[model samples]
Target: MSGKAGTETMFRFTCPACEMSPIVDAVIRADMLANGCYLCGTQVSESAFREVCEE
Candidate 1:
């Protein structure tokens, strides 16, 4: 067994418009990436999405 198992960081994206939670688990891949809520269309950054989800 490797100690590095399950050490990967995960990102949880939440839609601000419809409140669709757990949207995507692509944090590191999301860095410098821009995308909007598929459910509605609220444009937001990965970091911004994270902050909103935390609240």
Candidate 2:
């Protein structure tokens, strides 16, 4: 993917504390989402957000 198409590959990181999801400007690898929070210093992953969204 390139140009506009590459933009779609970007993912947003949501803060677990404030529930503020920010669209990260940089590209995030699939594995990186399994770690900790980049915003509110919480330990979270993509699955965590999915769980929150489900509730």
Candidate 3:
């Protein structure tokens, strides 16, 4: 097998409901749309997640 590997850029965001500052460090934009906040289970929206750079 090739030594090269693929990497998906990870994202970070806080839970607005639970107020968990940066609840995760390995989430992607798509994850937010497909799932809820991992900590509070709040319905996730695109606006809810902000790139770590925003901090």
Candidate 4:
């Protein structure tokens, strides 16, 4: 088995409008990714997502 089999990087997102806690396991794959926060219905920007520890 390969040693690097499970080294997927995750991202955390926080809603700017609601100031909610980091969003768990946020997967973003675009340079211009934009979405809405599920909890507070706020528009999420690319800058809001941050890199998290690899698992």
The lDDT of each candidate is 0.53, 0.50, 0.61, 0.62
Return the lDDT, model 4, position 4.
Answer: 73
Give the total clashing residue pairs for model 2.
0
State the lDDT of candidate 3 residue by residue for 1-55, as single tens digits.
5544554444556667887756344445566567787667788777766555321
Q: Put down candidate 2 lDDT per residue, 1-55, tens digits, no spaces.
A: 3435333444556666768775553334243355555555566666543222211
For model 4, residues 1-55, the per-residue Cα lDDT tens digits are 5677656667676667888755455344232144477666676677777878754
* Tens digit per residue, CA lDDT, model 1, 1-55: 5455555455566655677666355553364245466556677665544532322
lDDT of 3 at 50: 57
Top-lDDT structure, candidate number: 4
Candidate 4 local accuracy as lDDT?
0.62
Better of 2 and 4 by lDDT: 4
Deviation (Å) of 52 in candidate 4: 0.6
lDDT winner between 1 and 2, please give it: 1
Better of 1 and 4 by TM-score: 4
TM-score of structure candidate 1: 0.48
Count of backbone collisions within predicted model 1:
0
Cα TM-score of candidate 2: 0.42
